[model samples]
Target: MKSLLTAITTTVLLSACAHHDDVRPGNDNQHYVVIKSVDRSEGIKEALGQATHYCEQSQSNMVVLNETIDYKGELPEHDYLKTRATAEFVTEAGSWLWIIGDGHVDDVAAVAAVAGAGKLHSMGAPYFVTVNFRCT
Candidate 1:
């Protein structure tokens, strides 16, 4: 009886392994763009716009968002940045991309690495985009 149980267990384990092998791999490296926000203003808008323009070169791109934020009315010292401009994205490579138009901003590094891949271009102060990516 113990021998029969061992045989059944081995067969089940092998079957599970075979099933796992059947699972196909995915092309996670598929390129896409996260628009985040599209503004025509000098701040955040310009930076985001440049990213949008640059991302257009990619055939398989995804626009993250197409909206604008107004931070003028909010208090500068307050945590208005948390709500005013926010974006989240993922890439196969370990990096962050960030684009901003407002000179008054925080967490620029995290944003740039995830979005810009550390390649940042400034249209002006507070108007810049940083790229982060990896080809898989």
Candidate 2:
């Protein structure tokens, strides 16, 4: 009986831990970005607030990051746009977005790095932008 209880407790704990991963401040479904440094960037809270406002106004929650972001896989178009918009707004608002994932380029820094560096790499999807913005 004791062993059974222990097993159940462990299972419950593991499940809870997994659930908590999603609750992390930057790991949620929000778009991830990787700003180059922390020196001149606004923190996440201010960016999140503005993002929430933009989302509320646009009826679309496009969460963005100010830096490079890597994700496990390719994000869908709508999700990407929403995340990108959020990232752009926050970056413009003086916040920096850092990457929260590790598989693919999902953050602005990464995109900017690639685009600026003139590297031709694709993560199974074509990302094309006619206009580009440079940040100091």
Task: For each candidate in turn, give its C-alpha RMSD to the true structure in angstroms.
Answer: 19.0, 19.2
The local distance difference test score of model 2 is 0.39
Output the TM-score of candidate 1.
Answer: 0.20
lDDT of 2 by residue, 4-115 (tens): 9999999999875442121223324443322211112332343344444434443664544443222333576566556555554544432222354344434655565445
lDDT, candidate 1, 1-136, per-residue tens: 9999999999998875442221122255432222222232544444344444444444434243333443333235243333224322222122322243334232554454455432222111221222222222
The C-alpha TM-scores of every prediction are 0.20, 0.20
**Cα lDDT, model 2, residue 55:** 45
List ranges where model 1 is wrong by over 4 Å. Answer: 1-40, 65-136
